[model samples]
Target: MLNIPLMSNNISEEDKEVLADFIRTSDRFTNGPKVREFEEAWSQWLGVKHSLFVNSGASANYMTMAVLRELYGPGEVIVPPIAWSSDISSVFAAGFTPVFVDVDMSTLAMNEDEILSHITDRTRAVLLTHVLGLNGLSQRLLDELDRRGIPLIEDVCESHGTTMNGKKCGTFGLASNFSFYYAHHMSTIEGGVICTNNDRVYQMCRMFRSHGMVRELTDEDMKREYAEKYPDLRPEFLFAVPGYNMRGTELNAVLGLNQLKRLDGNNARRVENFKLYVKNLDPEKYFTDFRMDGQVNYAFIVLLRQASREKFERLTELLRSENVEFRRGTAGGGNLARQPFVRKRLPDFDPSTLKNTDFIHFYGLYTGNYPSLEKEKILELCKLLNRV
Candidate 1:
């Protein structure tokens, strides 16, 4: 039913050949040398000291939060209303209360003032997501968090090449998460990574990625200390933390390594695609003044400027007739507070408080934007929407 789907496979035939060759030659297939190589490459690319490869971005989220909880103890975490479920789920799982903050309409990130205002003595970290490849970070926000001594954990699952102040979004945070799902900037079939500069956090994450074994720690001295501390248990079998088997395989790493080479080039194309998209869309009828600097948009966000049930319905009808696939309530299904998961936990939660988030929930939708997308098609889609 869809002529223009939400996502097209970015994985190339060359990537497959590399994987095939690896499979034919390598004896190891599980979490081994290739995975470590990919992790190192990703760390270098992201400008972080260490990276831990995991099964999914959701696992990266959970592991980062788990490590944070182990190191910082239980506390509240400031979160954005328009974020992936894993960002909040990781917080809840880490035994931290999620304090919601409304988003800035322009950037689609948590308002800097709102996030700062919600900070309390109990607040442990601010888990911010660069929604749909938009850089959801600012200099003032970083400075304020640093001044308050609160860690800033970034959920960069959707934003791979997005930057702020000439540095990648993930590099600025205490720890950041990335996804390599098929639809993302890159693909490993299914994989994710956690990047950090903190040595202790890096070591802990390495252990957590496997079965929390001392053997997983890269530092020899730390492994020795753990071994000395626990004599009864075997050094290799000693579990420092109750960690899950969230390890990624060598095959995924192989795909990732191949994809990594083309990431920058592909991202450049996406940036251009988004620019062309906003250039033609009718600004009066739709909102197009998004913060575009340092952005590599994942999709073309079509948000109505004013609330009109007639316009919304007509827009959907036109898209359907044209067979252009899209997702409404773009980015984290709009306001997360309105979701049953949040409401069931906090019965008093109100969605109206997050005005910008709620507006997007009702009126916004995102269509696919990938590297190979045709320019003429983009113009045609904009023209169709402008008519609506």
Candidate 2:
């Protein structure tokens, strides 16, 4: 019964009406022209050459890892200790070892210094997750990756409009993933997309998304080559690689097309709300100087200036009394290295290796910051938070 919930659906009644109309009129409801149309629109928006819409953000991550595994066989992928389960799980699923790294407390993202130190000869790529819409990558990090010839994969599932150096976050990486879940900056109810400038990666994503069907390949010559290689099988049924059916539906695309129109404006409002939150929050009690230069604030991440178990307990109690909903530890289920799923694999794992991550795990929190959040409510929430 929280008055302020951690997330609110962005889809409006007008959006639902559009979806209803499409359902009633469209010739097909499965993956069809609408999906392709949405993909093109997203690519145009992200300034990427191609985009492939999929079932969920997790699927997008898995597909990207799958492509990388094909290009470079099993190796280590640098990942943040504080990220979504899928970010690490996808790496494992693709036969790559996940090398967990500490995060910078200010940005709640992988620490650039730690990432560089962890890069070994076995390092295949760096999987950077833009946690809670924060633009975590820096030019220095990108430069280092470029110098080392290591690919950068961006997981921008929580960051739809986040930018860095006048360019959008998804555009900087070799491949980028975005989520259009009901509660993200935009919504397709449940959809995800993978964008890339690399033609090979783009075609591989398409082939993997639809049961590895050669017909999904845009290159007619490649399709014909596959057909010739497998003359015993039906041309349309040719499976190139081991793939999964992670295709998104036309209904999801119908919603995405409309959502994209309002994404930037909504992100702007969230930024304004974050400014107000930072202005009103008591700096003595919380860490408000979060890195905001190229960040598109997703949730109001409240990191306590000092780690005190008692103060955290008091804050949570006050938040409950005021009915302010929040998620502890920000994003990804917090401290992936500490999670039982990861622990089972690396039984000797030491959580202390991620110093800043351990601090956030014990002290950080985040509440909802949607477009509809008002300055007055933000002020009120800050007052409640400070009272703790």
Query: Which stretches of model 2 miss by more than 4 angstroms?
Result: none
Give the clashing residue pairs of candidate 1, or none: none
Summarize candidate 2's per-residue lDDT along 1-388 as a digit string, tens digits: 3388877768899999999999888789999999999999999999999999999999999999999998889899998888889998899899998998899987888999999999999999999999887889999999999999999999999988889987999998899999988888999989999999999899888899988888899988888888888889998888888899999999999999999999989989988888888888899999987888878889999889998999999998888887888888878657889998788877877988888998899898888999988787888888888888
When summed lDDT is taken over every stretch of 10 residues in candidate 1, the lowest stretch is: 1-10
Report, for every candidate in turn, its global Cα lDDT versus the true structure. 0.91, 0.90
Residue 279, model 2, lDDT: 86
Give the C-alpha miss distance for residue 45 in model 2, angstroms: 1.0
Give each prediction's root-mean-square deviation over alpha carbons: 1.3, 1.3
lDDT of 1 by residue, 24-132 (tens): 9999999999998999899999999989999999999999999999899999999988888888888889889898999987888999999999999999999999989
